[model samples]
Target chain A: MLLLVLELAGTAVFAASGALAAVRARLDVFGVVVLGMTTALGGGVIRDVLLDVSPPTTLRDWRYLLVPAITSLAVFWYHPQVARLRRAVLLADAAGLGLFTTAGTTTALALGAPVYTACLIGMTTGIGGGALRDVLLREIPMVLRKEIYALAALAGAAVVALGDRLQLPAGPVSVVGSALVITIRVLALWRRWHAPVARGLDG
Target chain B: MLLLVLELAGTAVFAASGALAAVRARLDVFGVVVLGMTTALGGGVIRDVLLDVSPPTTLRDWRYLLVPAITSLAVFWYHPQVARLRRAVLLADAAGLGLFTTAGTTTALALGAPVYTACLIGMTTGIGGGALRDVLLREIPMVLRKEIYALAALAGAAVVALGDRLQLPAGPVSVVGSALVITIRVLALWRRWHAPVARGLDG
Candidate 1:
C-alpha cells in the first residue's frame, strides 16, 4: 500500500538526520547506528508504549528496523558528500516529519483516541524521536527549544482535523496537510526564524 | 516504615551515581540535576509506563524530584571531594543496585507478574537508568557491555525466588538478597574479576 511506502520513506529520512547529528557529535560507527535507529523508531515506540500496545511496532515489523539500518549505512559511507547536501537533507526531514505526524496522529484517532489526545500524539510522533536523540546526545531538545518544531506538527494536525471533519478522502488531505508542515518548517529553519519571546529571566 | 526508609536510601544512592556520572560528562548545574533525577527515577518511570500506571512515581511524589536536586547541588559544591571518594561512590552504587533489584522484582511479583518476567524487570530496574544515561552520553552502555552489572541483579532476584519458595518474610528476604548482590558486585569489582570472552574483537 502507499501508506507502507510513505512510512518507510519517512523512517529513512529521519534516520539520516539522526546519523548527521551523530557525525557532528564525533560518534563512531556503532554510536551513529544507534542514534539513527533510535531516531527512526523512537516516536512509534513511545506511541505504542503509551497506547499499551504490547510488543511494540519496532518489534512486530522488521522493516522498521531495516530502514534505519540501511539509512545509517548509506549515511556512514557517504557522509562527506551527504553533509554538503544539508539543504536537501533538511527538506527530506521536513517531509518525513509532516508524513509521520499525519500518519501517527490519524492512526491514534482512528484507534479511539480523543481529539485532544490525538493532537498531542501527533505532535509527539513528529518530534519524539528527535527529542530522544537530542537528549541522548546531551543537547537541549529541538522540540522544546525550537519554537517552530512542534508548532509545525500542530499546524499539520489541525489541517488533518479539518479534512476529517469535512469527510475528505485521506489521500488529498495527507498531501496538503503535510505540505503545510514541510513549508513552515523549512522556512523557519532557513530564515533562522523564532517565535516572539518576552525575554528577561531574573538572574 | 523500614521498607520506606530503605527505598529512599536506595533512590538517594542511585541519584548520587547519576550526579557522579554527569559530572564526568561535564554537564552544567542544571544538566547535572536533570541527569541525577533521571538516574534516580528513570527505572521506575519505565516500569510504571510499561505497567500502565498513570503519571508515574516522580509525578506522584515530590521526594523523587527534590532528592536528586539536593544531591546535585551537593555534588556541584563538593565535586572535588566527591572525585577523591570514587571508591565510596562505587560501593554506594553497588548497594543501590542490590536493593533496587530486589525491591523492583518484589513489586512486580506482587502485581502478579510471571516470575521470570519479574526477574528480568528486576535486572532492568537495577541498571536501566545507567543504560539511559550512557545512551544520552553517546557512550557504550557500561551496564550492557562491561562490568558485573546486570549479573548482580540476576543473583539478587534468584535469591528472592528461593526465599519465596521457602516462604520467607519478604522484608528479610529482600534485605538478604540485596546484601548478596552488593557482596558479589563489590568483590568482583575489587578483585578485577571479569566475565568470560574478554578478548579483543576483530578490528
Candidate 2:
C-alpha cells in the first residue's frame, strides 16, 4: 500500500513537470498529455522491459495510467498556478527520483539480476523519463550535461546494492537508500553543484 | 539465416549514420561508439522488449552484439569516407527501415497482438533507432519534422498486416512489403515530400 501510494505521487509530480515543459514548448493539448504521460511512465516502462515483464505493470494497471493522465490534464488546464510553484515541483521531482531508484534496485535484486546490472537499471529508472522528455523537446539531456542528477541516482542505487550484498533488512535499507538520494539531490540543487565538462575542447 | 544476414547489414548501415552524426558533433571516441551502437541496435531492442523477449535478442546473441560494435568502431576510424557516402547511407537506412518494420510486425502478430497494435509496433520498430539517435544528438526527430518517414513504415506494415489477413504467402508478402517501404522512402527523398506543419502558430 505504501509502495503504491509513493509510486502514484511520483507519477503525479513527473507528469506535472512534463506537462509544464510541453506548455513552454507551446504544444497542443494532445501533445501536452502525451508528453506528460511519457515523462511520468517512461522510466518504469523501460525498467519493466529490461526485467522481461510483459505488457508492463503500468500498461496493465489502470491506476498507474490514471494518475499521470489526470495530473497532465490538470497541469494543462491550470498551468499558470503550477508554473508559479516551480520550486515545489523541483522538490517533488527530487523525491520522485529517490523513490524510483530504490524501487528499481529492489525489484531488480528480487528478480535475480547481478548486482552491477541492478545498479545500472536503478539509475536508468531514475533518469530515463527526463532523458526521454529532453529528447522529445530537442534539448540536451540535463542528466548528461548539468547538475549531479545521475550521480545521485547512482549513489542511491549503490546503497541498495550494498545492502543486498550485506543481507540487510530490505525495508530499512530501501528507506535509507531513497532518503540518501533525496538528500543528495536537494543539496546539489541548493549548492548549485555541477559535473565537470571535458577539458581542452576549444584547443 | 537470411534474416540474420539482413539484420546485421541493417545494423552496420545504421551504425555508420550514427557515427557520422557524432563526428559532426565533435564528440569523443567513446561518445561516437556509444551513439553508433545505440542507433544500430535500439530499434530491435525496443521491438523485442515490447514483444516480451527477455534480455532482447541483441543483448543475448553474440553475433548481434558483435555486428554493431565492429561497425561502430569502423565508422569511428573512417568517418570522413563514410560522410562522403551520405547518399548511399540514406538508401541503406531506407532499406533498414523496411526490414525492421516487417520483422517487428511479423513478430508481434506471431505473438497474437491485435492488428492495429501490430501495425503501430511495426512503425515504432522502423523509426525507433533513428529517433533515439536524434534524441541523443539533441535534434528534433526527423520522422516528426521531415519527409514521409514514419508514414512509409506504416504503409509497409499495413501491407504485411493485410497480406497476413488474406492468407498470402509469407515470404513473398514480406518482400513486397519491404519493397514498398523502400520505394516510398526513396521517392519521398527524390521528390522532397514533407508532412505539413501546424498552421498559424506565429499569430
Best by lDDT: 2
Task: State the lDDT of candidate 1 residue by residue for B3-70, as single tens digits.
Answer: 76787777787788888888898999888888888888888777666445678865588877777779
Number of backbone collisions per candidate: 1, 0
Q: What lDDT would each prediction earn against the true structure?
A: 0.78, 0.83
TM-score per model (chain B): 0.93, 0.94
Query: What CA root-mean-square deviation does each model show from the true structure?
Result: 7.7, 6.8
Candidate 2 residue-wise lDDT, A18-52, digit = tens: 89999999999999999999999999999998888
Q: DockQ of candidate 1?
A: 0.09
State candidate 2's DockQ: 0.16
Query: In model 1, what are the clashing residue pairs, if there are any?
Result: A136-B136
Q: After superposition, how far is residue A125 of candidate 1 from its true place, in Å?
A: 1.1
lDDT per residue as tens, model 1, A1-203 = 77788878989999999988876666656557667877888787788786675435553576777889789867877787778899999898888889888877777777888777877887788888888778777778877887888889999888887787788887778778789999999999989997877767654
